[model samples]
Target: MFDAVRNNRKIVQIFLVLICLPFALWGVDSYVHGGGAGEDPASVGDTKITAQQFQQAWRQQQDRLRQALGANYKSEEANTPEARLAVLNSLIDQRLLALEANQARLGVSDEALRNFIARIPSLQENGAFSMARYEAALSAQGLSQPQFEAQLRQDLTLQQLVGAVGESSLVAKSSTDAIMRIEAEERQASEFRFPAAQYSAQASVDAAAVKKFYDENARLFQTPERARAEYVVLSQEALLAQVKVADEEVKAWYDGHKDRYQSAEERRASHILLLDKDKDPAKTKAAAEAILREVQAQPAKFAEIARSRSQDPGSANKGGDLGFFARGMMVKAFDDAAFKLKDGEVSGVVQSEFGYHIIKLTGIHPGKQRSLEEVRPEIVAELKRQASAKRFAEAAEAFSNMVYEQADSLKPAAERFGLKVETSGWLAKAPKPQDLPAYGVLGEPKLLKALFADDAVKNKRNTDAIEIAPNTLVAARVVEYQPAAARPLTEVSAQIESGLKLREAAAQAKKAGEAKLAELQKGGEDKLAWSATKTFSRLQPLPAPPAAARAVFQAPVGKLPAFVGVTLDNGDYALYRVAKVSQPEAIDEARRKAVEREYSTLLAQEDFAAYLAALRARTKVEINQKALEASDR
Candidate 1:
């Protein structure tokens, strides 16, 4: 029903990467337990939706919203009952789909899964699948190969079920025709606007009116609660600068992993392909052999002959060049033949799935390993990175323990890690974008909750070390705190007066416009000037205001001319006179087909929604409200 279903293959590939891969990016804690140890958040039929799964889904959604909304995103908004229920419903839907898929015995084969992984552009190097890059990427996300592959296979299976439901939709021609008729119907209209600004000079406001407004809206004048803190950060980058690697360690690592630096052999080859589609196999092979002999006899004419004889459309115009390729990149038979030939040498006829090929080897690059001197800088950097990682792991535990054991001040932890205690500017519970660096761990939800705990703020104790991001620990102590308070009425009187005056002006304008409309309907004339007539339809928008356009289309068509009035967004009023209504001559074939496709997609979406509703009704869904609320905390 979504465009993702219509353009199924490409969209599914993108969805697989974005959805499945990010599960691994959630870190090692995500994989510790597949389900929570306590009560379930929800249950679908016989299966339970675990608390851990719901929590992970909530966090992933929060991260996605933060990225999309940027500075406008607030993490606390996700802690509400409605947001938690939405997440629970999504988990229930996924469980239902997975149950159906399992019952149907639908699956993805290993070969198909491998091919899909190979095609992912992120795992490739130089347009070819790189095993080293693939392993490194998975390791960086903290996922094993089997874990990623299993998730990918499950997603592909679910896509098969979704595609089956979406592709079966049908659209009737009569329905399409009826829709087009209404969409193509056009109206011509004239408008007269009553501007609110014209009445502003007549509006009067006194001190009593301003005082009443300010009293009723006192909440708008309150200042938010703020706090300032001193904190320290222990991150991997900070530790990396302190780590030092010796020359002997670098040499030892290089010697143990010498095979990692060896480059694979590559070959550059061109071929003349003879088609076996209509001709006999023997004849095709004989022709290929003849071309090979001619090429061997006259090497310069190989390109000329290939251009006329090759059957591959992609390479025929380019003299049948296949470019340079490493082993396992091409078919086994072709790779074997090409690698066996020396530079500037020709080979006999070779048979493949496509046709018979007369191969010519133009270049060869032998496999070689770099000397330690040539790669000394790279080895040293890798050794230092490895050493830094080990040190960070050891220091992270110490940092957490010290902060907890010595809860009064950050000075002990900072002295232990050699990190300076830094002071931050005023920070609110909901920090702005510019305050993120100063707030540090206070910007994170869990740490912010802890920092605002009754004891931490009142007693001036330090928070427990929190992992704000991967491998980054932070802890803070409150240095100053201020409670929320309301500002004095004198400071906000001017704003209140200005707001009340504008509202009074808009009300006066609306009253005058209504009186004028009534007089015009009773055959009286006014001095207001009307704009030129413009045509509009449901599909083709006019330059008039949206309220005016909507009124023009909704007015009765039987009456030759009709009048309608509406309030515009600028606090102005508009009266529209509908003059003429016209129907389209005919619907073009191309546009009709497009409309039919769109209509069918809408029908399919409704069908799918109904199907899901039916499935929900048939199953017994039990939700633990208390457990759901506890999980949010």
Candidate 2:
């Protein structure tokens, strides 16, 4: 039922990915920080990294991974010492950037901050910013608008500092051309195989060898424990469909929140901004007035003039179009000038905090009241969600108690909460995150651990209900269990013997291939039979085994018929004859441009890394081991 600002609102997303992938954090040297209110996981200079700070950052990273990977997210994997260290390091990097930015007196403007927040997809509704949705999102995250705005401002300031550092990075023309030449060179080659299978007859493993190898590698022959389980999930989504919202409630909500449903009067405007860089405001105003006269004489050419003359980086490229915005969204002078103009009318020269502006009003959307019928479905859904949340909270405790009190069956809790008890196929004791999707919600680590626990597996009991997600609780019972066991030596003897023989055969093949390669390099004639020739380069490569292809590409092309050999993991040895080398007739212009962009990006990444390392070297850091280890919560 809540809707506001019906306009095509676009934000200039001022994001610059100048650093390395994932993150590039500052290095730290440890010291001690005493007399703190509580334990700190880490500290940068005088600033302490609180447990709450570390955990929040960790949770945000985990949430991003979960959204990006969907069902493949592993909570346990992220809650590791390594991940915690990375998270703490990122926070330190951010702090360093903030410190540098503050000292540099860098700042983000009101318009930039509003537009940046507007660009957040979750805070938007129907392709526009919604005040109610923004409020709700902040509430859900336990953040106030001021708190969020402060963090956002700090982030934008960091962007400014880092973007400057990254954009300053330069790539040499010679470097780019050299890399292009190296990648463009192609070599024609044919393979000569020294097959390990040919040497298998001479390779042997006696009883003493097999017994010793088998004894040392006992775990290799053992099978991991597996289980099949039945589980039930209790979540707000499960309760939402069942919790009905009455027509009366929907109508009452719409009537009470009519003010929230009023679409705002938004104006679309384009402007040409002129900055007084040399502290000469009078000159800047005169220049803006001249542009204003030109714009007034020919309103149709306002965008064209703005594109060439406007100094605003945020909007000049788009012909100075700031999209549609409500009143008071801009600075006071700019706002008044923009809203006063009629569609297709150009405004007189206006002065604002940024600079002088010549404004042109392009479009207008008038304020309108939304009808009750139009917002009924939205009101119903909101009411349903509210009711579901309250009901879910009450049922969650009962669900947990029933699963533990009864301790034998999940049916009591399932039937009481109207949830279905789903069964899974064989589940591993410690399944890889990629394999967890097969088990559904039972893939949750805590539930899986409970399913295979001694009490549950030995005495057929239901697991204690665990909150797997925000509002999702799960309890599972082990239906079938398989304990970890090793295969008998008698059963594995043949397999062991074959493995030993194959390994020895591979060693022999490698030795022979390398000897031949050495001889060929010394100008000795090879009587070896070669296979059909095929061409390859760095860009276009061979299939199947990649190690052999890598060896070929990396081999020197100084002499004709140069030789290179590689031992295969599967017990085969290959020697390649580098017969010919040639370059393409013409290098594609588009591919050259792509490489230029990639090389520039690489330079930017390295520059940013060096900058961070410099900051870390000067800044003192202290890490509390006990607090860090206890932060698994």
Candidate 3:
């Protein structure tokens, strides 16, 4: 089917039109019919949006979001009601555009479609179209070349309507100039903040008020529901503690796999390196050749020459010694030259990416097989791990069934498996996910949820065995359950008093700041120390809360030193004195052009939306709300 679609463009184009008859892309059959045979997710005019089409679009949207968020993507972030509605609305818009294009008899030329595909940045390499890259991109999306082109043609036809509507949009030069001037304007201001702490001494809370607040919001003082549990864990590590490997078994395994104990040969070498510092490769090569000749003449003084002349600071300090390393550890040219030289023998000038080098072979550690005594501990450990893993695999199914069939206590399973019945401290009904790590196996989300189930908490029944990790199972039962209760009034009174004082202090600070602002606005005389005046703009604002910065820009500038007040996010009141306002003297032509482009694009989008709205009004659309919501599940 894929080969045939790739071979015939006309046949693929026809196939594309026929395949989307009952989907978001409208066909002649859909344009004449109201809906498909079965109930559909939505319908724009007479075209039905099929469930399969909705699912495909939904999955595509999911992929786009995952790619955008990268590692930050969360499973629960998708499939929200708002996300589903956005997808459905997108499908409706596509259906509307397809219907309009069909009615207008719009079409894209074959050459035009080919040009669009070739110009795609992903399909190009070295600034030229690459057939291999284009084919791989299509293959990644499970699309054939002809099928992709057919779809591209339909999209290009719809773009014609978009272009027609956008061409009708007109942006005014006056509006662009006014917005540009506003953006370029700057304001100077001085700030004075009234800290909430200054009013703390004056805030006196009455005993009656504190009691009333405590009574009204008692839930805040209640203790959470928690339980203590007795649990048993069946894991490979737990089984490994019981596994003992015999000396005979270790000997047999080591003898059978002696090749695994062979250690690769390692070489230790020293080198003097010279790098091309002045972008003159010939000068560096000459310097390296001179050093090589010096070392060759005085063989015993190689270390002395290397220390004085080598440019590699790391190895030069230690007489140009590079510690022992196995093959393939260093650059290819350097590694080959170092290994080819005999002990204490120096090589001629060798060139690598770094520049030039002279290498000396110092020591060689040949490959060798280990004796039985040297690797006995390692062999014993490997044998025990293998035995434990096999034992755990066989016991896991029986463990799961035993816990469920017993269903009363973890004792039966623990005794049968020679495991300990561990006890937990108080655990909340729903502990924070991050805090679960301290509980070990009990921290696993699935196991924790199971342990806190109502049946386990109230009835004191063992939870069904849950796989907490690979080859690890856990079953727990509540030994002591604590119902939700309230802490005593006396125990929480001090906390309530501290909170009440802070709230009252913030209120008093705001009241005082407002009075000072009112007096200043009335042109009254007052002395308030202000921070150094700073000039700021919408593009570059003062280092303060957004509300404080906004107060500076929003103050009236008719009079010098106008005052404005705002309560900040941290519960402090701030007042600003607007000293001066100014705008740029000359217009920047490049900046003007950029702003004009942005303003024109906004106008074009508005015009296109209006045209789409006019078309939607003339068409009949129906949506299945129930089916749309059900699809999320």
Candidate 4:
């Protein structure tokens, strides 16, 4: 279950973002301004951090945190003083390093910046950078070309500094070999189970004792407040049904975007490849000729031969089929050969950078223009989308204005936009996945903020229209409010009783274990009298109990009479009076080699940290401590 989620798209995306955003400092703008932002946040090089600067940096950090966490974002946690202080400190540290980097004249060239920007996926379409798209995206994000470039440059600079450190760190063969050795080795062992009931003849807790224990820790049985709320949602999707596209508009759209309806010529082919690299040209020629003869002899079995003998791992599984690709997408020689061959025709082995190939033309598709009549429906839908977007925007603006002007009942605003003013029954401040009727729109930050606003809260008025996402808008009002209250004992009697029993049992166990340990310390050692508990190494399976193995290896090491108490998984406690502690010696040479590889990786990590520290030393940095602290304020 855990591994499945780890590979989920959202989880993987979050993991990559977390890895790249922080400690790695892999984002943009770390370099151009300076090597790093600064050495420390509060007092970098004797400069007091200013509140304004700290707030700005803190906001940016908050944005990064939000981006990284996505749906799991906790507004309160991010807005807290501790989080603000942490962000401020990071900003100061970056400033210090960036200043030092500048002093050392560590800069990125303009060409590098251009290349970096060009490579960004967001700015590309159809495998080529789109200037129009690049501009539109920057505009949407409210960033100018120069501003974006400068930030990118700064980011590149910081990366270079970090990369420099990583590159200098060498991975020793001895280390890698040790690691490889362990990876190639395996261990075999047997295990046994010693269940609690099997080990202890009688272990019980009385009802009276359970009740007493529950009285002492009653809070454990209490439940957090829960609520069911109602809301009204408005979004572009809601308005989509209201939009209409005329037939004339569809026809005009199709005529203007005719290129979109054109189909390019496509060809399907298979090949057998031969390579000239690392072998004599004459020898390669001989092998190609031999293979060609064999293919010619059994022309129908070319695919089977390619599947078994082709050197191209990428396409071999599909019998060396390149699928259908249009002209200009492949290398000149390969493209020419495939396009010239008729369906079912085979060509002699062709050579390219990867290798030589026996080409077989399987199918061909001729280029053709699509008629407007054939694509009219699609064009109409597109026109409707454009029209709908404009209409929705206008409706959204009107909705916003109506709420702002009225600032009272949602009835007025809702009537104006023909949207219902929805009300929630009650809602807790704790973040939750939207589950209310009108929550689709009300869950947005803007709507939530408005609902909590003094005007809305005091008058109990509806919130203004808020955009949750493109085209979606929502308006909501809180019908009733409830402050959190402690749950009554009667409401949680069963829970309390269960918790009480667990506590009483744990207490009893701990008392018995403690007395047993005291006796052992004095002279309870009668080898046969001592109790035995099975233990396992890290990553090893435990005996039948289904318990984790980490605890076994983490237990204290000593002879009999030494006791260490640890809480059991079931909330009970156990004291292990050490009879024996097994020491796991290092693995043999084969395993040792694998360990070495890991040790080298560890060394590289250390070296990288050291490099960052050095870069910090070289930068001339200053931080406004006062400003940073003010971020929390």
Candidate 5:
């Protein structure tokens, strides 16, 4: 999880910005200007959320959602007015928190920021900080060292404010006990289902009722506007197909960057760890030194001593063997000692963060560089990629211009770029498939909007080239069009009639189930068939009829058999007769503790939410409606 957080820096940065919003200031004047020269989407207190900043945040949210929903995700949903407004509101909340944090004089120090950055696993190599990798990652994201550091500092400062509120929350013992009692309660019950299918055979839907239902819900039967189109794409992948790396170029690259193919030396070592564990440092050190002295005198006993006494669980069972590791894999003190010792030699007691350790150097592997022949394919691919990138830079401008200039068709642009004008199957305004051939760009809201624009559709003209993805441009022209229209009643009459009959059946089932339940409550036994008794609890639920299971637990326990009725999802109605109720004799301590921790965490979250709400109440928040709406456009 930590590696994922570090590798997905863009997503993590956006999440930090959002989570830290409540601790930043906002400028009222920025919001008033509203997406103008130096305008903001909203403001809290006196800090402004700039248009660029808001846009980056919105895009980050879209990316996060896309990742979560996978192929089912749609970019068009995030482009809506409501979605944009939600993003703006989050920015406002962030500004409110920022204002409060600033007034409290909360801050993160330079040393703390450096430490935090150094700890990111993705920015490290072989478990050690690597400055080159860190710089390269930031450069890839278009952020400088100072810019990234400043954001990190801001995030840490906001964390301080959130921590204070969350830490103050306390869960009462009485509340914990009450919740556990209910959660542990169990009940046994029998149920009878009044299946709607039984009633449907007797119920009939008339023409008038079907027509009324259809007329009231006409919008549901309307077909969305659709089009068939021809499009051309200009992308790096497309350009790569036309790019070639000569043998000489590949050889030259390999010669100039031969050092990149070299691997560092690695060593395998073992150690008996004596963890600090809040014990006296001197005592811990003395114990480790005793083991070290014993091992030095008789190294053969090292493995037995490690298995019996080592505190490091990860390696203790393996006789403290850490396996093969590079220079930077271990902490500095431990790494230095292990590297200096000869194979089969043991080092004196050394102190580190985890306390003292007795090191044993077991094996060593020397580093080597690969020959040219071994890396020729890699060199060729790298060189080819570089060539294609250069070509894309030069051709992108020409592609964009050609599409706009030759507006009638994609043929001219396609021919100029040595590309084919691909045709697509019928596509809805909001295309269902994200990977639709030729019309894949229609999955993107902006391109779809442009393709269906009045002039583009009516004149059958090509759209201006639009970047649907990074370094990928697409332009489309409508070949066939269909306007939005409602499906006639004749076409949907059967569907409406079926729906009306189901509704009538459901009504009959509910009536019969209620009558049966009343009869049961009045001490009258009906000939209705009841399922076998089943036991359930909040923690252990029944397989079917969850509503009946829930009703069993909720039914009154005074009578010998308590009765309740519920309408099921599949148009069936269920009547339950709860026969028994039981409570645990005693709460399991471990389970109770787990539940307590969860309840406490929930309470802490509530406290944090209340704290933010209070900050908003105290501060003056201004949202520029026009600017907020314009950001969506």
Candidate 6:
């Protein structure tokens, strides 16, 4: 289990499975259709959920997702209006719960939040909190210290709530047994599918039927709610692009830091140590002296002498070669003597800690100065970085003022300042615009607070220059608006058509497969006709890949309904009859332990949901729907 948890691929699969598990309880089929007054964001004894808190939590969740998936993250399946709304509502629900938790006074202390931040790897250096690193990261993310603190505080509060509920959860042995039994059980089955295409010939769509369907579900075709927005975005990278570094500045910088470019002297030398003092000190010295004299007479024979007589085991095997090294890299006495010798020169026998060593200078490398031309590129980069920092600050301040002064119209401000007015219609404020580098600023608590302010909503006015991030300010005003309403048939006709086509296909497939299943059960058809396929246990690979198999397994096992029919992704239908079900049994000890852990998790989740519900039922909540709509504009 530990190994599975440690494996990257396994961990990822587990994480995804865990994330999806919530849908089982939440009921994925319960969808938010178009819009209406959603359930109260919160409901205390007398107060209701407020727009301000909802937006705040919503923005926080967005930031958390961005942080988890990276700035470039987008949900591939959520591009359509329905899918997008589903994701947005899920985020909103989480926020609602978090706000409720806060109102119930289920929050973490400041000290706890501080400790948590300090322990985070991203904010630590060598296992300790690094103020410098924390500051730099906050700067990169375009966040102020206070903003980060507030976010951390809120997160801590939510965690506290979850912890409280989870702590109270209890898992009984019987519950674990049940879960274990299901997890380890296997099912035997066969399937038949009924294809809709088979029935298309018999099922004709008439104009009158189409008109009736459209009339009954007219709301499905209505246009989606949309709001026009005029927003000013400040990104450091954009500001940096306009900054230019001068050659003179680069040169001056290079001059000031010239000392850093100097290279140190290095020596390449070898020794023929003809001594081993540990055995006999006097004899070792005499042997060294003798070998030194011999090498002095025949200098070129030093390499041969080293190989045959040197007492240094490692270097002796390699002709006593000590590869090139800087002054401080070698032992003090050996280094001093070697450096003193000129290139290709020999030295007298020197005495030191190991023994005595006759040194020879195989080569000498002189220290040299690195010219300014060699490091001009580095200098230029430094200058540009400095210039960019200044540019971003100035541009941000100017951009903020412009948006604040010209609230309703972005054209006037944009044209005058040569700045582009970015427009986003009904964006949920998470996984923000990919093209805008500073969009993370929108996640800041202060920016959320200001954007949802009553004045900004009532007047449909631009937000004041609010610092969403360091060196980045944002101000936005609504231009166009649409109150949430049930969608009309015209607007959702295409969507309904697609849904209808899929359901029809499934229905047709099931009908045909049902007949096939009945024939197979009557022992009238070959098993091969059912498509030869691998049989799987309930705990094995998910049957999602084989929808027909899933449908058959889910059906009650009975002789009367001897077979089940369903559609497969390959545009085919399949019919399956129940073969046999393994008797429900207690799990083995090992499996039981695992199931116990899972049961504990399930209980905790249930408790947490209940806790959130209770919190929402007792909080002071007020919402400015108009303010929320205005900010998007």
lDDT of 2 by residue, 20-84 (tens): 12332221211123325458887778867777666767777787788998755668756788878
Question: Which residue pairs show backbone clashes in model 3?
Answer: none
Model 5 stretches with alpha carbons more than 4 Å out? 1-18, 21-161, 244-246, 264-367, 415-418, 431-441, 626-633
Model 4: per-residue Cα lDDT over 43-152, one tens digit each? 44544444444555666677778889886565654687676655654655555555555666788999888788768887763333557667888899777888777766
* For model 1, the run of ten residues with the poorest summed lDDT: 24-33
Score each candidate by Cα lDDT.
Answer: 0.77, 0.79, 0.79, 0.59, 0.78, 0.60
> What would you estimate as the lDDT of candidate 5?
0.78
Better of 3 and 4 by TM-score: 3
- For each of the candidates, give the backbone clash count: 0, 0, 0, 63, 14, 34
Worst 10 residues of 4 by lDDT: 186-195
Best-fitting candidate, measured by TM-score?
Answer: 5
Once fitted onto the true fold, the runs of candidate 4 whose alpha carbons sit more than 4 angstroms away are 1-229, 246-248, 265-365, 371-377, 404-408, 411-425, 432-446, 487-502, 517-535, 541-551, 556-565, 574-594, 607-621, 625-633
Span of 10 residues, lowest total lDDT, candidate 2: 1-10
User: Which of the two, 4 or 6, has more lDDT?
Assistant: 6
Candidate 4, overall lDDT? 0.59
TM-score of 2: 0.68
Q: List, residue by residue over 1-633, the lDDT tens digit for candidate 5.
A: 022232332322334454543322223223334443335677666556777878877877887787888755667655788888877778776666566767787888788888898789888643446576787899997778776776667667767777677667677878877888888888877778898989998889888987888888988998989998899988888988888778788778878998898888899988898888767999889888888888878789888889998988768889989899988767778889999999989999988765788999999998999988899888877777887788888889999998888898788889888888888788788656534554556667778889899998899989989887777889999999999999999999999888878888999999999988898889997676778987777776475577666677778889878888999988999887778888889888886766666676666656766766888788877778787778877
| TM-score per model over all chains | 0.68, 0.68, 0.61, 0.58, 0.71, 0.45
Per-residue CA lDDT of model 1 for 520-589, tens digit only, reads 6665765667789888877764668777777787877677666677888888888877788988898888
Q: Runs in model 2 with CA error above 4 Å?
A: 1-38, 43-74, 94-174, 197-209, 240-387, 511-519, 522-524, 583-619, 630-633
